[model samples]
Target: MENWFSLLQKNVLNQQSWTTREQLRLAIVYWIEARYHRRRRQRRLGKLTPIEFETIMKDPACLAA
Candidate 1:
């Protein structure tokens, strides 16, 4: 799948005219919440927030394995 920025540029922007910085920021927020934030798993919430969930399963001795 494409990264966050690419997805937003393709989907939300869709050549729409964003006349102000605020519009760009709003689009980014929508992308993050829809694509990233909601998809993540959080450990505190039992494997819910990818960051927290990933942290729960990671091994400190190895960065990536």
Candidate 2:
């Protein structure tokens, strides 16, 4: 949780200026959704996105272990 906050601080808080509270909220949501969540690779999927993992696993010839 601390690291996540640090990331937000470095990437969002320290980088830009907002004219309104609503704008700031929207910017944070955009960064988290578009840049952070979608792009971040997880170890559990062997660095693949969830969609990529699902596509590979969807192959009919692949056996589940």
Candidate 3:
């Protein structure tokens, strides 16, 4: 969590200015979804990215819920 915050601080907070709270929120979400989540690998997921792991495990039955 600390590492994530540090990344956010460096990449988002320090690099840009936001005119509104909503804009800041959206920027954070974009960075998380587009960059961090897509790129980072996890040991629990057998070193695959979350996106890759999800692709491998995706099932219509599971998604329908």
Could you give the candidate ranking by TM-score, starting with the highest?
A: 3, 2, 1
Worst 10 residues of 2 by lDDT: 56-65
TM-score of each: 0.43, 0.64, 0.71
Tens-digit lDDT track of model 1 for 1-65: 46756766786788688899999888878778877676766566776677555565676636665
Lowest lDDT block of 10, candidate 1:
52-61
The models' CA-based lDDT, in order, is 0.72, 0.84, 0.90
- Candidate 2 at 51: error in angstroms? 5.5
Per-prediction CA RMSD (Å): 9.1, 4.5, 4.4
Q: Considering lDDT, where higher is better, how would the candidates rank from best to worst?
A: 3, 2, 1
Off by over 4 Å in 1: 40-65
Q: Scored by Cα lDDT, where does model 2 land?
A: 0.84
- Candidate 2 per-residue C-alpha lDDT over 4-37 given as tens digits, one digit per residue, 9 for 90 to 100: 9999999898887889999889989999988887
Candidate 3 lDDT trough over 10 residues, lowest sum: 56-65
The candidate that achieves the highest TM-score relative to the unseen native structure? 3
On TM-score, the stronger of 1 and 3 is 3
